[model samples]
Target: MSQTVDRALSILPLLAQGPADLGQVAERLGVHKSTALRLLRTLHEHGLVYRQQDQRYRLGARLFALAQEAVENLDVREIAHPHLVELNQNCGHTVHLAVYEENEVLYIDKVESRYPVRMYSRIGKPVAITVAAVAKLLLADLSEAERRSVADKLDYPMYTPRSTPGAAAFLKELAAVREQGWATDLGGHEESINCVGAPIRGADGRVVAAMSVSAPNVVVTAEELLTLLPLVRRTADTISREYSGSNRPKKV
Candidate 1:
């Protein structure tokens, strides 16, 4: 890869974490000051990045536009959208599409139910890896050491009474999720909200994303969640095949 291109790509996550000045950016990326400046200039010209008045840098509008287009054109979503609609209508619950990125689960798409009492999950919002059922679904794909590294990096805040309390506790829950091939969040992220999620595997047979159904605890009991497992798992499996092509054996 071109030096400038590599630098620009590396800078994206640093900018996404927050904004940063040239010196800070260079420090984090382990490049010299001169190289960072040249890379930033090139990226700015391409509209992939931009600078603020105070001299801090951020992802530019062009990158956002590209990401929006990519999200709209994602093959997996194109194929799974009709299925998501069916799942939402049949289950009468809010169905969300989430992909694992870095140490967090990012919600990329959702179909909300018409019910008055519903969880308001928005696209582009990120939640802790230890708090959401979707996170657990993705976590199951990681090796034990990989999971521990991720758990350590995570904040693991107790958003609700059911949220995992610490890294060790979270790892135990992850172990169970791995064994079960599904995950449940019972009022963990929000009070009275319950979610059940299953991992979406790619043709590489690696877990790439999660498909989840969220409902109020009163409206969808634990038993109801269990009943919905097959639907969630099957939808995820379909997405995996469509996106990844063929199933490769999953490694633990």
Candidate 2:
């Protein structure tokens, strides 16, 4: 690496330990005080470092802002949207993408069916945690302690007779989902609706999000819905590959 770029990058890890004075930074970098000061000035101009009231240098607000922006840009919904649409086209049913964040599972993307009969759902709405297939898939990936904690905290609304009744049942269901690597909500969230979901994993093989296919019971029986499981799993796997950059175009 170029010496200037190398020196600038080195400052970040040094500051991460704790704020440091100019002399300390210079000593650690094994550079002249003037050289360290010049480097710090360049970093400050880019908002990568800050000079505090105590005159020590620390990481800057801009660094955090940039980190936030990077996370937002890596949205799984954006990566999964087209796959959801393609799955919807193949199955003729509603397709949804969801993620668990801040103790809530919410729909981030959706592709409505072309059929006259369709399920009523909106993107960005929090899921029925006890009964949504996507919700189950997302929650199933959490550790046992986190699963129990979240299960205890949820309201087990009886939207239907098939809805999960309490934490014990919910935990049991999550265990089944975790074991199977996929999930379903058959007339649980809505008496007329059935859903099947599979986890979309990151490069580390952790479920970062989930996608589901939904069809009204009036349109398809639970057995028929189950028939789509392979397709759903395939689509989820495709999204996981793309999101993890495993499918990136190879250089010539």
What are the lDDT scores of the predictions, listed in order? Answer: 0.83, 0.91
Q: Estimate the TM-score for candidate 1.
A: 0.74
Name every residue pair that clashes in candidate 1: 203-244
- Per-residue C-alpha lDDT of model 1 across residues 71-131, encoded as one tens digit per residue: 8876656667788888998888999888877777788788988688878777777856677
Error of 1 at 95 (Å): 0.8
**Which stretches in model 1 have alpha-carbon errors above 4 Å?**
1-60, 244-252
lDDT (10s digit) by residue, model 2, range 1-252: 699889978999899899999999999999999999999999999999999999999999899888667545655777888888999889999999888987899887789987899888886678999999999999999999999999999999999999999999999999999999999999998898999999999877789999999999888999999999999999999999888894333442
TM-score of candidate 2 versus the correct structure, residues matched by position: 0.69
Best by TM-score: 1
Best by lDDT: 2
